[model samples]
Target: MSHSIAPATISSPKDLIAYKVDNAEPVEFTSSKGYEERRIHSEIYKRHPHIHAVVHSHSEAVVPYAISVAPLRACYHMAGFLGADGAAVFDIAKHRDPAQGADMLVRNEQTGAALAKTFDNSNRVTLMRGHGFTVVADSIEVAVMWAIYTQKNAAIQTTAATLQSTYGGTGSDMPLSYLSSEESSVAREMTKRTVERPWQLWVREVESCGLYVNTA
Candidate 1:
């Protein structure tokens, strides 16, 4: 199906911000930085019209794993959402700028595009070490689901590590190929449900709260 955002009635950034706060995660925007977020949102929307929402968050496990030299693997079924190979990690250490906030830790537009390109032929999911994550979906519900499931996978891995250390059990050994199949199925279902039905609800909420301004 062709993925595209319909012409929305909401205009001002405040309305968008309000909508985002009420429906999804609470977004922080000072008057000074608020315009910047709005601009970014607009740019993202313009570039990826099909993307209904863009989520920026810090997944605890993913953060440490990114900083470590070893690559982070998907240890649980839920992590399949990141694809069977697991999400590719882009080394953003060179892109770091202390002046920018947590998000800027990934550095400039080049870094962002590089990270996005990692998922070029796939669905939404990318990790930035010490920065956070960026998940793009056709709707907020799908985006939120990806965020939650990824965290669940991380938590499971953490628990598995504990068990392996204490009880001498083997850690998660699921291969990427197996995980990829599961991830595709879950992503399909989420896309259908979130995009077909609840997306309207999300749009309305974001419009009302003005948080939609952060569309980039």
Candidate 2:
């Protein structure tokens, strides 16, 4: 589980708490704050064995599209992992159990399973309505790549749409031309080979800022 205060850091293996798919509490340690949300990751891993890394982010740029009627599309070649059809938004309300009550968070196994089912083998990203988005990949680097580009894509698309609406009078309601399926497919393959490039850059930044210390 991750600490609510510092969501991005993993100082050591001690930061991780082992837990089963069915249980809400960590078997080895006392529960952390916001521990219930960890169910989302466990359920996703239970459903997709091939996915080794899962990243959930509350990016402001992507949240608008998730809450809006429009879906977030892959506006550029780097974001090809989002696919041509765009990412699907998962609505917790429809799947929530009224008896258990609703908090819009994946707090239990049932809600987590519902969230997991929203993802298919080919789907790499799923946006949570009024919440955030999750990305799954075979490796941590690829997952980070998808997560970063998803935010970038949303910002770029929003800016482009605003420009069109302001200057061209097309309105933001109109859909901008997105990448074609063929374009995305080929680009997705090509981009996988370059994931390490950005990962190295980010690692360097972390080191330079002294955000991560190597105890080993």
Candidate 3:
């Protein structure tokens, strides 16, 4: 079948393939195929020309904020891309047809468009309620960084909030301090440029495992 590709089996550049954004038809003949998440990926690239890469991940630590009202703000400088207000929540239930029950998946064009719409001018991350989160960036490296640090921020935030509620004063009263808008802007610009450092480290680690090889 041409509708499935396993990441672990991929060894080099030839394992990768391209597809059209409009209909997701393969650009070249290959046994590999795109995943179901490609629906939102395609819609995002189609709607936002500036976004060169999109990463969707189900970081368990971040799922609490996605399903709750508590925002996932930047707990540290590295996650400044989350901004002061943090990631916007994209509820699949809002876009699902009444007849079709909520399965919490971007199953079609409507759900995909709804997900893409959540990425406003300031939104780099959108957390899908009861599902995973998506991060967008002008480059793949930056997107990977954002995805990694966003989950890290979530873990930190969750831990802090738990400790504060248990030991400190009221959790609501002692709200965790987050980066300001100005601070976030400055940190985002500064950290995005440093993505290559971590990218190289990650590439070396992956290559060491013998599961992947850099062809470039």
Candidate 4:
């Protein structure tokens, strides 16, 4: 994680090695929340007062299309919410000079602010070009589901594009089967009901596996 973000700028995220999940407090360290994670989360929380959680992920599946001209379409049945919310891309390459070699890192306050604008309008999803994506939701559970669905959509879109090209399709000729707005609404509501089960499972995993339990 430090390779992608400068540690000096981040207010020290309770040493990764020391963080445990047994519901015990830190013995010597003055542990705090994820500094940099809080940085972005703060912006989203402030911008959308109703939003309760923000999820950022560096999904490899979304990377290829982020850096390419091909768009991540609503290609999967389970990813219907993506189409309903409207997906968008945020290219730091376009936001900054090419010679600077942005390296897919939001290096400072200015960059972070620029990235936040990626959620310009109605989109709860935004693709960080050459980086990853950020998902905003009313709950952490929904945000988690959004991250998974985004990657799944990206993978499905990639496959769909590949199949179209292999069959001699060109440019706008690519095949697509996006759900209608009405269909997406129903699907989104149905999907929301299913998030509780997985979220509970994740909570169990966190306690059972000690996944960041040092500050518990």
Give per-model TM-scores: 0.58, 0.89, 0.90, 0.71
- Tell me the tens digit of each residue's lDDT in model 3 across 106-182: 86778888898988685999998998899999998999889999999999999988888888877467778899999
Report every candidate's CA lDDT.
0.54, 0.83, 0.84, 0.65
Pick the TM-score winner: 3
Off by over 4 Å in 2: 3-5, 21-34, 171-175, 213-216
Model 3 misplaced regions, further than 4 Å: 1-3, 29-33, 99-101, 211-216
Candidate 1: C-alpha RMSD after superposition: 9.3
* Each candidate structure's count of clashing pairs: 20, 0, 0, 3
Which run of 10 residues does model 4 get worst, by summed lDDT? 17-26
Q: Residues 1-216, candidate 4, lDDT per residue (tens digit)?
A: 222334323333434322111222233455343333344554555456677777888889988867787666566566766764357888776666555555677644445667667665646788887678888877878888878888988887788777878885766655466777787767777777789887888778766763334341
Against the true structure, candidate 1 reaches a TM-score of 0.58
Candidate 2 colliding pairs:
none
Colliding residue pairs in candidate 4: 20-213, 20-214, 21-213
Q: What's model 4's overall lDDT?
A: 0.65
Model 3 alpha-carbon miss at residue 59, Å: 1.2
lDDT winner between candidates 1 and 3: 3
lDDT score for residue 207 of model 3: 74
**Residue 180 error for model 4, in Å?**
2.3
What would the TM-score be for candidate 3 when compared with the true structure? 0.90
TM-score of 2: 0.89
lDDT for position 66 in model 2: 87
